[model samples]
Every structure is written in structure tokens, then in C-alpha cells.
Target: MGQAFLPGIRYDKMGEALFCHGEHVEEPSQIRPALERAFKSAEEGKPAVVNVMVDPTLTNLGAISMAYAVLFGHVPYRDLTKYGKAMRRSFLGFAFPGFEKYGIPDAPWPDGWEPIPPEMWER
Candidate 1:
């Protein structure tokens, strides 16, 4: 129920075996490129981190789910209602006994936001 703050540590100083290319993706548009960079680094036998930053306001299940859909190219849903249906399915799939009563909101992507291309998932 409480949050803790830890001072940041430099990744490069962790040791050679753990050296990694750290990429911070702050928006949906940057995700694919960041992932590609990480993959290329990994392919070259280097570690990488593609840290996709979700909005701080998205603190609930439904909101975070919608963010994932949009950030990961699952969106461009046929209609708004479909998003609610998807949320309902997701909620039912993961809801536990005491958490079953939480409502699933019709969360939608922001206006003018674009989906990551399907090819991003490939390779």
C-alpha cells in the first residue's frame, strides 16, 4: 500500500557481464524502434532494456489494459464497444474472489494515437 524510492544506480557500472544498451521509450511511437534497438543489441550478444513508460494516470486494470493494447498494436478496435467487451473478458480472466466486484471501464486510446505496426511483433 506504500511506495518506496530508491536512488538510481548506473547500469554500466554493474559489471561487464551486465552491460546493456538502455533505451527509454516514453511514448507509443518510440516503442517499436526501442524494441528493435534492444533486439539488435541482444543479437550482437549484448543485453538491452526497452523500458516503455506508461502514463502515471493509468493506475487501474482497465486503464493499464487499454494502454497495453495501444502501445502493443492490439488496437484500432472495430468500435469503442469492443474495447469494453475486451476489458470485460480480461477482467473475468484475472479477477479473484475478493476483487470480482471491481467495474471494468470502457477505456479507449487517446485521440490521434496510432497503433504500432503488426510487423513489430515479428522477428
Candidate 2:
């Protein structure tokens, strides 16, 4: 809930390794540095988890919500610009067309993916 991350072998592997541990929380300052390291390490291979307590929440829209992620790729008519525009208009495409069909503004992610800091949206 404190950070968003794209999935990678390191994190994915961590997820698989921790299939048994319940849950984990990460301390702050370490997050950005950890993510940055993971980004670079992935170029070579998966990053290593030096600790046993942490559990990676690997987020892969393509994998977690494949059907919904594919919805964008399937839009045969819309050009790139329009699609990007529509997606940003809401918090990560919340309430945007097609996403509603994926079940937004509803049960899960209760805020409907509304941007965390609304100020970032002005640009």
C-alpha cells in the first residue's frame, strides 16, 4: 500500500518463495533504493533477497488481470495518444471506459484507483 512496483524475477521469485509466510511490511528509505537496485539487477538476473522477512508483492497487470490489461491492447480503433489520455484522466484508468467492465469504482481498490496525490494530476 505504500509503494507500487512492476514485477520482476526477483520479486516474482520472492513471491513464490514466501508462498508460506503470511504477510510483510517494508520500511521506508529502503524502498526506493531497493526498487532501483532491482531494476538494474533484473538486467543481469533476479535481485537477491538478503533477508527472509520481506515478501514481494509482484504486480503484473498482464498476469494478475490479464483480461483487463488486454482490453487496452485490443482496442482496434483508438490511437496511442487517445488511449494514454483516457487512461490518465482517472487514477490509473479508474472509471475510464473499458475499465468499468473490469469492475472499477466498486468493491476492490475502493477508491477506484484515484491518484494518491491529486496534485500530480494537474500537469
Candidate 3:
């Protein structure tokens, strides 16, 4: 899968002809900077693509995992609820706590709800 991105990166070198700026984010720390550049380029009337490299071995814990964990008591129900709420808030334009430091705008959480810390995300 990682190899598949090489062609796209080469194509982006065409620059103005493509009307798009491309960034290859190879590490976690690169995410914000790449996204910032992409946004800046788009704001200047050019489209942008940030090709973020992800660890293929890292399994995502999504809805299925949440349900299984809650049902099997692998994770506390309240914890998952908090994480779910945080995700919902992010979709609604509120940045999760740590993400705010990366230039994402932060909004107050609804009363009684706080974003679960990033350290708890995979657990």
C-alpha cells in the first residue's frame, strides 16, 4: 500500500499543471504541518492533498470494537461513551483536547462532557 503512493507523489511534482499541491506525511508529528500547508495552498485557490502514511499494522478500534469491548467488559461503558462523544464533537467542529495545540479551533464541550485523553484512545 505504501508503494502505491509513489506515483501520486511523482505526479504532484508537475506543480501548476496539476493545480494541486501534495504533501507526503511520513510520521505522526508531520500531520499538522502537512495539513496546515494543504489548507494554506487551498486557500490560495489551489487544491491540495496530504498523503498521510499510516501504520498498516495498527488496527483501528471503531464501532465494532466499541460494542465488543462494552459487551465483553473489556472496556468500561462510560469510557467508551466519553470517547464516542468526543468523536461526535470533533465532527461538529470542536477539536479534541490535544488536537487544539495543532491549530485546530477548540470549542467548549457541552456541560458534563470532556474529551477522553489521547492516551486512552486505544485502550
lDDT of 1 by residue, 1-123 (tens): 011112353333453346777876658998889789888988998888655555432334434353444443443223333433444344333443422355534333432244423332222
Instruction: Report lDDT (Cα) of residue 24, candidate 1.
Output: 69
Q: What is the C-alpha lDDT of each candidate?
A: 0.46, 0.38, 0.48
Weakest ten-residue segment in model 2 by summed lDDT: 114-123
lDDT of 3 at 113: 30
Put down candidate 2 lDDT per residue, 1-123, tens digits, no spaces.
212232332543565485521122257656666565555655666443432233333322332242443455544323323322333333345435765674533323323233333322222
Ranking by TM-score: 3, 1, 2
Regions of candidate 2 where Cα sits further than 4 Å from its true position: 1-25, 47-123
For each of the candidates, the C-alpha root-mean-square deviation to the true structure, in angstroms, is 12.8, 12.6, 15.4
Those runs of model 1 whose alpha carbons end farther than 4 Å from true positions after fitting are: 1-17, 60-123
**Which numbered prediction scores highest in lDDT against the true structure?**
3
Please tell me which model should have the higher lDDT, number 1 or number 2: 1
Return the TM-score for candidate 1, rounded to 2 decimals: 0.36
